[model samples]
Target: MPQIDPNFVFPVLIGDIGGTNARFAILVDSYAEPKEFPVLLTQDFDTIEDAIQSVVLDHTSILPRSAVIAVAGPVEGDEIPLTNCKWVVRPREMMERFNLSDITVLNDFEAQALAVVSLDDKHLENIGGEAAHPNGKRVVLGPGTGLGVAGLIRSRQTWVPVPGEGGHVDFGPRSQRDCQIFPFIEKIDGRISAEQLLCGRGLQHIYQAVCLADGITPCLNSPAEITDAALDKSNPQAVETLELFVIYLGRFAGDLALFFMAQGGVYLSGGIPQRIIPALRNGSFRAAFEDKAPHQHILKSIPVHVIVHPLAAIAGLSAYARTPARFDIHTDGRRWR
Candidate 1:
């Protein structure tokens, strides 16, 4: 276990790097909140080090002695490659390039999970269910460039984040409409993983599948167009696509809650959920979440919330950097202090 240095310097760098965007922030002091810097497009930079330098050196005057980067992919070995991005993050190279004394890389969802306890009413929009259990397990997930999942367990007073590639699990159809749509999805991708029909690309695929099922020519070109059409009730295919998306999201959340026994709550984060708040508040999401028989009662008791904080992962990474011992990070069959 690594010990927290009593003389450790202030002003740590924190980042939440996804496939599309890389968000950076700095924690100047223990009492001060993280100050966010302008977001950088991942494609603009060829390397993660370049992205970090562009943000840290160009904008801020503060020189950080350490950093904690939350990446939207599995963090393993020495090279952590993002699932949906072209850049590969090599920790040792970054440390040398940035002149950092210490650095930690975490799965994006692991950082999101760490932020669960830090979230308050202002950062959350409740969807359904009773109050969260005081000490029950909490599950955090969302769809952005891809789907991410993690669980938060309360050990003593600290929270332990359990990150996994839960998004890649086989997607199971739950409704008559789902059964019909699966064929269309399988035709395109050969196999239907949960992420295949739940993330940004997944939304587009769902729109295509809906159009095919209705014998209509596919017209929507992007996820944004589909969402816009659905929100305005302009296209029946887009509307149906959003409906199925909400239902599938609910089912997936419920399944994860069951798997983690998340009585604390199920939190929806990422770029997609905040945009589709109205669809989530509708009855379809809750109805599908509680549809599982014999376990419906348990599901009903689990609270569902949408994380509205834009820089939540940065806050999480900041917390972990300040006190690494407070978190239980599962990586390479080891736990860091």
Candidate 2:
């Protein structure tokens, strides 16, 4: 059960646990900077606690009194199973193993949204539009192990991070070319979801779909190969796949901008955006994003930035640890004591 009063004790341990990597940091005090540890691969550890014990506790004598974990899964019940990884976030077990007073869990994108709130200009590259509106609503979405989506809304002085399975929303072909190729794209649970065609595997899916649509033999098996071939324009099929990807991404971002009425801006996180900066900036992305018939004017003012921060989620956890009052995370049944 959650503690009656969720008071975050100092010397807190904060982590951004993803499907592939788990990053941790320690906030010793409000004034001191976060002491970040080495990144750990999820498959290398048997459990989330084991990785923490090996990389963090084993190396440093600085024990934490509390922990705030942002995982790539829904934060529910005592056991929070990661969507893509084998490791599970067991708050009860973590509390007992670390001898911590409290543990607060959050969705991975929720952490990303918090980073959106605290991030500055240097960590972002402008893809389109003007400067962000001060304290306005913002969204952060990206494709990595999967497509992650989250939004930030300001309420009084604190910012609220809204996290959900927005990535799984239905995405259909809008153009004639899309209709010709989208049928070959893979489907999850029978229907095509945004993540189905926008993730690392999604890149492969797109390449394969293009190959099948054009009656060509599929060669690229990995996302890296497809992306590299696309970037270099060494393969015509790969090039077309990348162009389609950019269009799909823009359409989704635009849709979210209109849905959330996000005036602050849309931040593209994850590894994909950083890799395809050139493709994203070639004007096709912005054009597809602004193609909404009646909503072009609204999207014009809404900016889009790609987050270039390598350790954004860890920084977000650090921010929450340092100033928990600034973000409304709503740790109701999530915090275990």
Candidate 3:
């Protein structure tokens, strides 16, 4: 059994589920900060429900009446699947199991996209683009365990977050080098999605591919280790890996901008962008991003921003916890007139 907040009828149990980790928090009051802020290792808990239960036990005695979970999966037919983890969250089943009054499950990237609406300049680090348009449609993307992408539409006065699986979209190569690398990756993966070349694992893959391109011996390393070596300039291959990684990232971001028509601009969030800000600042990211054939002019106008805030998703979840259940406005701002 869980303890109940006698004063408040129902507290909000919020979660941000990702491929590698899941962050859980309990919002007891409407305006109070989360009482239980527990970040769980995804592999430790077999199920999301189990993880939720444990967090409730550790942080609060209250059994929440309503729960809002941001899952790293597509929300379809009341059920959602975790992108990298082995868990499926069925809102009705989970709510019934926990005796919740209401439940909402959203795409994790959607949550992250919505999260950026409230982020401030202090939370962002300008990588290689201009400032974001205040009242324009903004693009938010993050490459963690998996690449997550979403768009925010600004309506009359609010923001509506649009969910997408853009990461799984086909990879478009711009140059002869890219054309060569594209087939190489496709051969190994059978199909190379954006995730194949835009994430942490993707960084390693690019390093290996570059090695193959230059006919150098491949080196095995963790993402962090590779970044460190690349930054130090001690390893030429690592430096090349980072360079190619930025190129792919920029080109991919440019593609996203074109797809979303992100007039407000594009923002690169998650852990990767922050780690290589210097490289992104000095690298050929801008050239790659603006490499569209006919729409280069349009892309040049779209500013690309990078979010440095680590707690962006959590804060967005908090905002979602308080958002009206049936509002006319979508999370990004677009509303039904």
lDDT of each: 0.86, 0.90, 0.77
- Model 3 lDDT per residue over 141-233, tens place: 888898999888876576778888888887766678776666556443466788888899988888777777778887757888888989999
C-alpha RMSD values across all candidates? 2.3, 1.7, 5.4
Name model 1 segments beyond 4 Å from true: 1-8, 187-190, 330-337
Candidate 1 residue-wise lDDT, 1-337, digit = tens: 9945533256788889898999998888877888888988999999988887777777878888777788888777777789999999887787787777767778899999988887678999999999998889999998989999999999977789998999998887767887787778854356689998889999998998888887899999999999999999999999999999999999999999999999999999987999999999989999989888899999999999999998889877777767766776644421121
Q: Rank the candidates by TM-score, best first.
A: 2, 1, 3
1-337: candidate 2 lDDT, tens digit per residue: 8645545788899899888889999889877878899988999999988899999999888999999889998888988899999987889888998999888999999999999877778999999897788888999998998899999999979999999889999999888988888889877778999988888998988899999999999988899999999999999999999999999999999999988889999999988999999999999999989999888988988999999999999888788888888888788778887
State TM-scores per candidate: 0.94, 0.97, 0.88
Whole-model lDDT, candidate 2? 0.90
In lDDT terms, how accurate is model 3? 0.77
Query: How much is 271 displaced in model 3, in angstroms?
Result: 1.3
Residue pairs with colliding backbones in model 2 are none
Worst 10 residues of 1 by lDDT: 328-337
Clashing residue pairs for model 1: 324-337, 325-337
